[model samples]
Structures are given as structure tokens and as C-alpha cells.
Target: MNEDVSDGWAASAVAWIVEQGEDGDYGRRFVLDAPMRARIEGRGFRNALDVGCGEGRFCRIMQRAGIRTTGLDPTEALLARARELDPTGNYRLGRAETMELSAEFDLVVSYLSLIDVPDLGAAIARMVAALRPGGTLLIANLTSFSTAGQPDGWTRDGEGIPRFSIDHYMEERAIWVSWRGIRIQNWHRPLGTYMTLLLDHGLQLRLFVEPEPAGGDPERNAVHRRVPYFHIMEWQKPA
Candidate 1:
């Protein structure tokens, strides 16, 4: 992850989450929310990949849902925590846009980490390639360029990693950040944009999730109700 654009919180943030076991406080809050989980579980995917998976929380969830799952992330700390969480879980340390996998997945999904990658098109294209014909690609991210805020900016650190306060929000749906020297980026095409990309890549749109209001857990929900800001996109590769 680029340190300059992400405020130097990319890997440590995941570490904090793994240490705390809390969801939203760290980076996991944006993508792994309950409603999104419901959408993924409802799909009934048999084989799946979790791109930019941090500490493998979503991977564990996928396993419990009976989906055979693997996780991919670039950060060593996050991968270590993920391994600790699920020793048997399959995980690889690599960039999301350039992963190497032999098996095509029934579903390829990403949570909040897309905003940190550097090459959105290459990443999406690679993911599309990793899907089986008629398989699904599920992504969640900040929906609009204007809707989300940008990080501060970039500067070099002692470790030579560019450090910055930047968060990628793109006009054309491509967003990325360079932090402390590491560069991570993602794309956030609107619903139509995703449809077009899917079509161009030989995938078909299946579902699009708009932002929704969050309700209290009643039992003991701690998350304060707020206007939802993320989009959940589901697309399928044609057989």
C-alpha cells in the first residue's frame, strides 16, 4: 500500500483490527458490513476469492458460509493475522491487480481495499479473467467521485515509502493512494460504469446495491445510525 496517499495507516490499520477484533474501527468497516454480508451469502457461491482481504475476516465468514475461499493481500502483517485467524485458509501475498491463481473462482469479491490499489483497469481485468464462465465478481467501494473525500497528499518518509493523507476518489472510477512509499489503488465506476466494464470484459451485471440506512442491532448495536455511502456491485461472466 502507498504510504503517502493512505496516511501511513494501510497495514497498521489492519493490525489494529486484528488485535481489537472490532470491525468498523479499522478498515474493515466499509465493506464487510452486515447488509453486504447478506448479499454475498445469498449468492451461494461454491468457490471464491477475497481480493485485498485484510486479516481474512471475510475469508473466515466465507468459510462459515460453506464457500471454499482464498484470500489475497499485499501486506505481510495483514496476511499474518489472516493466517492466525484461519490456519487452514488459503491466502497469498500479492497485489490485487496482478495475482496469479491457477483455479478460476465461482465468485471474486473485494471489500474496502479497492481504494488502495494503483491500477483499476488492470486489476478488474485480471479479476474478470480469474472468474469461471458464468462466475460472479462482487465489489464494494465509494460510489461517486464527488461523494467520497480525497486523502491529504503525498510526501517521502525515512523508509523511502511515500507518505500522504490521500484517499483515491476518481472522476472515471479509478482511485489509488501512495503511502509511506507503497502505492495501492482501486476503481469506483458507477452502476453504468461497472456494467460497461463487465460487458467489455465479457462479464454480465447481476446486481447493484445502493447505499442504505443502517439500523440498530436492537440486541446491542453500537454503530451509530448514519447515511450509508458504499456501493455493492455484482457481475457475472457469461458461459
Candidate 2:
């Protein structure tokens, strides 16, 4: 992780906590939570690790499902808040690139957090290393299309129809974004970059899905359907 990325989250930690109340934003509540939980349900996972687990929400979810989970993040403020909320839960202060664990977890998850990682190759290596054989690595990330439309996410034409534009799709760089007082630098990489890294690391792809919003405000859902924002992937290490 870049120093600026860590600092950005530290500064915006409070705003992020407030933005993600008990449930999460539209994406998590409607598009991700159900499917992610479904994938973990009855899988007999003994323990899990949540990388970039901001505020420990998913960690708590795993705990409720009887999976021992450890939440790892670089931001101390977020980890502190997570500990405050779930006093007994395990929360570790560390970056994914430098995570010091080996074959220790049945499942490792990256929930909409991969974008913030600057050295994603290193981070992915560490995440794969942390997983036990046959373990699953679940990831939810913003689509490259969505990230490509960084500074100007969405615009409206004369007809008042929303339009998403993309350029330099193959370029890998950092873009600063802010919303609801939560500012951060998010790294953007082409879809192939992520796929190649996971495959090169010897992870077998189990599932690849671009999940649409299931149910939400009709207007918002319509917009999301037009330009799907997120996708989820399930990869397994050889046993």
C-alpha cells in the first residue's frame, strides 16, 4: 500500500464509518452481501481473513456464521473503530503486501478493497500465501470500466440520460476520489491485469460474476444496470 493511500483512509476513517452504517452502501446491501454470504454458507470454512476489512463489518458477519475471522487493515483508526464495535473480534494492523501469515486461513476475502492497494501484485501474493491449500479467495472489486471513469464518474447528455465514458483503459495509475467527505486514492488497472495475476499465482478460478443490483430504489438500480459497477470472483488454491 502507498503511504498516501493509508493516510487518506486514516483521514477519512470517520466519514467512512458513518457512510457505512449497520448495513453498507447500495452496492454491498443490494449487489454483494447476499451472494458473498451465500458463497460462504455451509462451505465448512473453519477460519477466514478479511483483507482491508474497514470497520470490521465482514469480519463480524463471518463470526456470526461461526467462522473464526481476523480482520486486517493498515489504518489504525478504522481498526480501532472495529475493535470498539466488536470488542472480542480479532483486528490486526497491517498491509496486505506485508501480511505475515502462511497457509493459515480457510478463506481470505477482499471486499471492495483491492482498488486501494497500490502494489497489488505483492498484496495478491501475500493473500494467496495466507490461504491454506484448497482454501478460497473471494474478491469483490469495482469494474475496470467503473474505475476508468474516475474523476468524472457519470454524466448526463442533453436527453438527461446518464452516460459513462472511458479512455486510456489499459493504463495503470492512481486516481484520487472523494464522496461524502471520504477522500482516497484508488488504483485503476485493466481487467486483464487482475485476471493474469490471480491465474499466474496458480489459483484456479471457481466463479466469476458481475452481480447486478437485486433490489433497491428503482432509479438507482436502473443506473447500475446500465453500467455495472462491481464484480466478484472466487479462486481456489490447489489442495
Best by lDDT: 2
Backbone clashes for every candidate come to: 31, 0
Q: 120 in model 2: Cα distance from truth in Å?
A: 0.6
RMSD to true structure for each model, in Å: 8.2, 1.4
What TM-score, computed on C-alpha atoms, does each candidate reach? Answer: 0.71, 0.96
Span of ten consecutive residues with least summed lDDT in model 1: 218-227
lDDT string for model 2 (109-155, tens) is 99999999989999999999999999999999999999999879898
Error of 2 at 146 (Å): 0.8
Please report, as a residue range, the 10-residue window in candidate 2 with the lowest summed lDDT.
Answer: 1-10
lDDT of 1 by residue, 1-239 (tens): 56424434454555345354834433234333666678668667899999988788878877878899989887767778788878999989888678877547998987766665666667788888788888888887765532333333335688996443323433544445444333445444444554565688867767777654445343222221232346777787888
